[model samples]
Target: MKQFLILAIIVLSIAQIVARPVEYSDGNDDVLAPEPEPTEIPIGKYLLFTTKANWIEATKQCRSKNMKLISILSEEDNDNVVKVIKAAGEGRIGFWTSGNRRKTNGVYFWGNEKKITYTNWEAGKPDNVRSNNGEEEQCIEIMGLNILKWNYRFCSNELYFICEEPHESIDETQPISLLFAQQILTVQMFGYYENNENEEVLTPEPEPEPLYDLVKKYHIFTTRVSWADAMRHCQSEGLQLVNILSKEDNDNVIQAIKDANQGEIGFWTSGSRTNNNGTYVWGNGQPLTFTDWENGVPDNLHAHTGYGQEECIELKGYHILKWNDHLCSYRLYYICEENTKQNLFSK
Candidate 1:
């Protein structure tokens, strides 16, 4: 009977041991369990999504949610995005941003088509490394393990992503009274008057007469055309090739180009050496008073080499927006300028 009881006890002990749950460990002191996938982790005005997807699918998902992939426009934006990812416990997983150079390699822009002015790329990054299949790394991802710096990556790589609510949507959520007060404040700031009925009335500001009694309007044509063809097209439109005679004029022309959002490589300006004197003048016979030339530009290399005269000037070099001389036959986008007479009868 003593041997039987001892054997039964041993059997019970073995059964209990076998039934006990097995703890999992991967050579670590602390045991870890599979974590649930995170979804819609919100931080500040952005949302972090942990579900993995390729760049194209990620963009589609964000759009389906009525949001856009986040655009890190500044250092603060970068920091906030990193914080959101870290807080979600996915700091080791890269997240896709809205920046990509798919349209024009080496020229990154946000989904909204605005040029990315600020960047925090890792060393030797954005090298545009090609895959074995010859696919280029055109999309940007915030490296989760590398101090949250940006790196160009293959667009088809599955990864987590972040999204940002548009400012217009936020504004729509504001209380009506608050929006009304903001409108009143804007009216007051713009020099409005309160009538006897206590209603605000916006008083029109006196319009200052434009210089030379004419208002200059700038236009950008995205169609690639030769310098002479561009000049002829502008003339056909009752305008002239642009004459950027002042810094203000140059700035205005740049703004116009940006507004067009046509992603042009360069624009033909009305600058060329009409006479053998070697001085550049506008097609409209205006002397070149202000010049924003890129360093070592207007070199006229082709002309000197007897290929063709590089007399026609263009606003080339993306973001540099500087002037360079190219052969007249080379096709490029162009800008046109129109002058309108000021309305003398208008109050």
Candidate 2:
């Protein structure tokens, strides 16, 4: 009887072993790995700007430094400016602002038509006292007080100012293209409330510091690739083709693309030969010197010729099909190159 009980116990043990799935472990390795380095924003620096520049020189100063002149669009920003100034010393006071009345003396204007209607002006000031400083003191400036009220100064006077640093904010939540780094959505909600929907961007503004650590060089496509494929190739190299802005802007970009493509490639462009009204013009604001379109290319099937979508422009030659789309995505091998020109800030 005891032997039978022992046999029964052995049978139950075997059943349990068969029922439970085994989880083997070497006792050292972890299942999950750490995130990639680029995914980590190192504790390097915060993107912010604070200036103590006096009025006149500040404009050129920000420009030289590749920054927009400081814009005090909110109380928080105002406080930040004040803190920077106070941290410096008692002597440091006013800095250049986006305001100007030089063009129309006595009339006020913010650098981008930002309404100063909700501004914090000192009592009984902007009185147009007509100071004997010289010409009509057209530019605007900001000077501060120990209290909330700050004084407005002339723009021509020299002062130091602050520039905000750029921050990389990737919305991992969004479906937007992940091709490029995402900048913060700098919605000027408060600035808009004060009728300041725009910054002084129409006028040429200063550029920001280099985003990448160094001027990463890339090869222009020696063989033409479609725009989609070109984008993928650039992604592999960590760069993109030169997006030309004007006729002169094409010079350096084209030179770089040519060097990379080895005279056998083309590029896609952001423009078409035909405009909305059907005028065929170079995206770089110049008339074409040559044409090479498979002989009968530009079929213009849609017939929306003037600035039409089908009317695309490509760099003809060397088998490289660098092309741009009427829809910003028509595939082609147009231009391929990379550059890092400093002092060229984005507006």
Candidate 3:
């Protein structure tokens, strides 16, 4: 019996070895597609606010911001983008890159071009899920920089978002608080004769206020108003504070109110962090997205692993003064801003 078993084991091993095929060429090791040649993008005048938006939403959001989706050029460009995202300094993290694979199968293609070359996917990513009926997945997402991983999710998941604009576009008439330039209020150089032997240098028009600051500019904050009360005040005047997005967004709010109020006290913002799952959803009912959390904060009780659990909140007065978690009924002096988009930046 022992001899027979040994002979059988050897036969099985030989059969297994014979069944496997070895490729003649080592070329299989050279799998990744070459990175593509990048376009000569203008000095980026605009730094897009990243969003977790799927393809459709991303496109729409970027357009609303008077911009478009980012287009990746080379691998080095990807690396630089990662650097800018990290340097943003908001505890809240992640930024949309110019890469997405929602169109071609398992291919990371640029939104604005063709000729895909470079690839920066995490290990075993772009699995490209297939259904029993033979449906193919076309959407992909990248998260975390240290080891950026791409995953296939529904096209409508409303993840983060990315915006793109020519560097020259930023110098256009945007608001100051939105983009910080010491000379934000200074005169424009374009078409202006500084040292020209012509007309005197006209006071450069101030860049338009950032969307958030502009919104707040048209708003008025009252003291110790309940959430409902605040909402009512805004509604009465055809205003609503339901669209805050980034930390810069929240900060913009505080800054507007503070500057407008002068010695006024702290008020409640329409933004909020969740006490459940630590998923920060803003007043728009969209997730309170963005990597803008100040460190050691938004603790969300630290119960949901590292992510916290506070949602539906208001920013503190003095412009994004660290946020707080309070019952909405606590009757805090709250803020109410008007949205002119649904109305022209009106009160």
Local distance difference test values of all predictions, in order: 0.73, 0.44, 0.49
lDDT of each residue in 1-347, candidate 1, tens digit only: 99999999999999999987665567785876554445778877888888898776676687677788887888988888887787777778889997876332244667554558899999888897765434567788998674688998887678889988864423322111000100111111123578999985545354323212245798888889999999999999999999887677888888888788744488999888846488788786667767788899879889778897788898884756788999889989999999775432121
Candidate of highest lDDT: 1
TM-score of each: 0.39, 0.30, 0.35
Name model 3 segments beyond 4 Å from true. Answer: 1-98, 101-122, 127-218, 235-238, 242-245, 271-281, 286-321, 330-332, 337-347
Model 1 scores worst on lDDT over the 10 consecutive residues at: 176-185
Say which candidate scores most in TM-score. 1
TM-score of 3: 0.35
Instruction: Residues 231-294, candidate 2: write the lDDT tens digits.
Output: 5676577665434443434555556665554445445642454455665544334344333344
RMSD of 2: 23.2
Off by over 4 Å in 2: 1-56, 87-92, 102-107, 131-134, 144-148, 165-347
Q: RMSD in Å for candidate 1, one decimal?
A: 18.3
Ranking by lDDT: 1, 3, 2
